[model samples]
Target: MRYDNFPDHSAALPEVTSTWSYHRRSSRRGAEEINDESAVSSEGEKEFLKVKKRKHKKIRATSQENHHWWYAFAVVTLLAVATRQVGLDLPAGTVWDEVHFGTFANHYINRTFYHDVHPPLGKMMVAGAAWLTGYQATFEFAVGKDYTPDINFVGMRGVSL
Candidate 1:
């Protein structure tokens, strides 16, 4: 059966512990984590809050510190160039396979060539390096000179490497 005048609805059951509103200063904050009324009364809760704030301060300090990555990048780039230069021209002197190829290259440049064993491309490649180095005396030196017994293992490898 229903009453006509503002049919009486049961009142909302009262909560045993009232919910509290927490003003979140940060958007990332979660819902009311502690019962505020009980939290303020305990000494342990105060110490907990202080510790949390100190950890947050440490995070802020690290975030605010300045760093220079460009200096690191510049140093690394310079080292790369130096390394390339050192390996580019080394031994100043004769090598093994360099002995063979360098000889053929010099021959072709002077038009006094041995019939190349491989393809025309092979002889052409040798002649190309001679042309690139401007038929320099060093090209002849690499082919003709007997090494003076230094580790100059790097001598011929220098041109290619």
Candidate 2:
């Protein structure tokens, strides 16, 4: 049932006739308003609203930023190499537990069976270093004993670094 003489309040209140249409309360006027710009045709058909598109900004790194990264990398690499190489062979006969590792290396070089609590990779590396330096497994590697001139202790220790 449609009222032919319905109150002409369309200007003050929006005519909500479709389920798809909705109202939003305006902050300035404190009144409900239709957000979508919709229009009704003479046959009572509603037009679809147009959506706004958004724009995005692209970012790129400058040459100075890349140069700063390279400078930091070079400084770190120099410090690492310098720290490892400084005083690597100073008054070193058997520093710390080198006597045990040296004996293990000798065992590997002499092809003899010896048991160690640690893994064999480190001992094998030391043995390879000693073999490359022409070590004959002659030194006893006793604790606190000075390394002889015949032994290339620096080369053997270099394997660790």
Specify the highest-lDDT model's number.
2
Where is model 1 poorest over a 10-residue stretch in terms of lDDT? 18-27
**Reference-based TM-score, model 2:** 0.55
Global lDDT of each candidate:
0.52, 0.72
User: How many clashes does each candidate structure show, in the order listed?
Assistant: 0, 0
lDDT of 1: 0.52
Candidate 1 lDDT over residue span 74-122, tens digit each = 8999997667667533444454456666677667667673875666665
Estimated TM-score for each candidate: 0.33, 0.55
Off by over 4 Å in 2: 1-71
Residue 45 error, candidate 1, Å: 66
List all candidate RMSDs to the true structure: 12.8, 14.2
Query: Using TM-score as the measure, which candidate wins?
Result: 2
Give the lDDT of residue 83 in candidate 2. Answer: 85
Model 2 weakest 10-residue run by lDDT: 47-56
For residue 8, give model 2's deviation from the true position in Å: 43
